[model samples]
Target: METSGYTTQIRDGLFDPSPRDSIFRVKAAVADELAALDDTARIRSTDFFNHTFAPDFVLTWPDKAERHVFLRMSYDLNALVEDVALIDSHDPFIFGLTPNEGTEKDSRIDGAVEESGAMFAEPDALERLIDRKKTDSTANMLSNAIAQGGRGTFIGNEAVEFASVVSRGFEAASDVKAAGTAEAISEIEERLGGPQAWRMNRVLQAVWEGSEGPLMLFPGKADLSGRLNIESLRYLVTYMRTDDPEFWKRVGRGLKMADLEHLDFAASRPNIERLIKANLDILSARAMVLVDDPLGVGEIDRESKFSWDIRERRLTFEAPGFFAFIGATKKDLESVRKTTANPVAVSTFVDRAEKAELAEVTLHSGSEVFILKHEDGAIDTHRLVGVSGQFDGPSEVTQAIATSSSGRVTVDLTAMSGTGQTRSKIRLADLLVTATPLLRDLPYEDTEALNHYLAYEVDHGGVTLDVPDDEESLVDDGVAGGAEPDDEDE
Candidate 1:
């Protein structure tokens, strides 16, 4: 009944039996109706006046990631009554127009942001699942550290296996999933049992152990998957383990890499793989930040700027610093009832853990995190660019967090000789984040016109923020790296 959400059966009722003659019949009917009209005002009221007569189909670049986007178009789903009026009265082709349109977000993955954000939900209850600290296991610790560090190397080199990079990124991000830094990288080995954190670390160990390469890999796909951008995740894994033959075996077979000759890698004879190394080296240092607001909303804003050349093969990313403000709300801590195989007297416990844990935490706004802060001329709304973090609060609080007057517009930037840093600056109604000029050791790699800021907030007991600045400009080499990032998730 449908090819792109349209029905062939509906086509027969609107027009004559001969589909080929419909256009001509509609045209003749239109001519007769126009001729019968005495005034222009009547003509303007005709059915044709409100419709788009003709439109153009946009040509696409096949190799670009964003090429053919699909959007569901519901406006034309209804079958209209046959009009005795003007043009296209018998045009069966009118029914053939698809009600769906191709979308334009090329960087998007197979799933939408909301769908991908579901992975961060709680895996199991506390008593049901146990935590396994990983850092105590020297062998895994070494392997994990190597893979994590090699992620940096792979970021400098694009050929690394995609799975390897993503696994490591996920492990690093998941470390912050708990209430505290009880399981820092140094403590992972001891924490490695069967907890969500351990399971993620176990996956990272697999990527490292997957054929003498970086440990990075995860499931192909899952519905409602959070922070689960397939290709982008794959790209990170591939970045660290390019030498592994199996890496190419899994991904290239499915994506038709050889068939895509129009891509820069396919066309260039001089330096096909030049950008590979350049991008890897830069992004390797760039921190992947995790943000949690009250609304099940998280964002990744970076202080690190990336640089890449389309003509020449070059790229870079670095993390000068990182910051985040995470909060919880009553709505996010609701109890969940579950039926399990090992039912123990239908037990009941107050769910201390935030039930809405990290659900919807993802790179929906573009990358792994979104930058929600922007510039406005108000005294409190100062700009704090190059920060990374998400709102770790419950969904209810996300609505409470104030944003700029203009609707939130998230953008990715490219830079040259620019600093690669990640930081998150959370500003509330009374709380303000002032982007102070560079002071102390700044993260900027170059002396570009970079904007910076500091966050002010209140914790369990007292207000938090350094003393207000006395001067506008800085006294040091303009590097302000000393400001401690926001504290542990509560």
Candidate 2:
């Protein structure tokens, strides 16, 4: 039988049927072994020897003060063993005082430093996903602006203007930097597609149409508050129109008097309800960012040095002087994807469109006159249609694209903030790269003192052998440090 991974089952064979008797016997055996050692030898070996008679048996004397030690071992799913010794002492844990009096100091700097460094050293996978989403959204927003020919769309000779008045109020209160300037936004929009640009403008106009004052969507008012409020409107419209009980329950806590009236009106008409949901989905799918307060606030900010505080739901900016912070739960972010049927295909097309940088082009179905840049490696086959129109179509764009490219499509739907946004893992090898600057900044006297202290600690902390009873006689006989080596030649 394959019994290697089962530590408990394997160790059980060593014991009698009764657990109490087994424990007693084990303790007796350990005590018996210790009794054989002399006081001097015991003291010397305590700090020197780590007695591992078996995988389950671990002993550490470390010194006369810390003789009582317990072994802890566990196996992971991969059958890898982790072992450690927890020492108990009558003397306080550190500084040679009673446990209650001594303020135990963790002198092992290496361990604490390594643990603190891991968070910043290794970039989290989730952070990478968020970064990609940010880039995609920025690109999409810029592309949308570019497609509009540096102007808003018109309906029956009336130009559809962006709700600049409402947007200005948000802009002034918050230091939120739009993903791009009007020119860049317009340029990218043109490059991606004109119809998409128009659609985007229309969506923006719809949200800002009736809003005269600050719309408080969330509980707090800080940077990116207004923008996130606008984004949440999409979900609000859907949940209210569809009468989603759970969504309503959650929103009820945050809803205002004006919001209640608006929802009541939206829920009254079926066509308006459908229109709102469709438009919201379109906005969410095109480019949206979901953050878990990457710029930590309150209790989290104090605890994490203002890094991400997912537990408290406080947003934090990765870099200093960052202007905006949007926070949301993963569930809220994923809901956008869940609502869309052909996200991958649309995402892939957007990526390609951004890459090509065309001013305007037709979709696959050859129905909608959209703006898309044509590059050397552009997607030529499998046309898309009705992308500009509501219910234009949902097709297997992902499957079609997959056939052309062997590489997998990666689309990140969320963006986060933190140091991980910029750098990857920092290994031990990076110590020189990181520490040199700090070392240079320190005064020569401090550096010398630091070096001397480290050397002294290293020398004193090292284990040493006890002097032999016949030290002089052994030295005279050419035996040193306890044992003499046998001459292989002889």
Best by TM-score: 1
| Candidate 1 residue lDDT tens string, 370-480 | 323213321111111112123242111110012221111111111000111112222211111111111112233322222221111122222221211212211210111
Model 1 / residue 253 / CA error / Å: 28
Give candidate 2 misplaced runs (Cα > 4 Å).
1-289, 292-407, 410-490
Clash totals in order: 89, 36
Q: lDDT per residue, candidate 2, 245-336, as tens digits? A: 32222222222212222333322333223332222211111111223323433432332222221222322122111212221212222232
Q: If scored against the real structure, what TM-score would every candidate get? A: 0.16, 0.15
Error of 2 at 63 (Å): 23
Sequence-dependent TM-score of model 2: 0.15
User: Weakest 10 consecutive residues, lDDT, candidate 1?
Assistant: 343-352
Model 2 error, position 249 (Å): 47
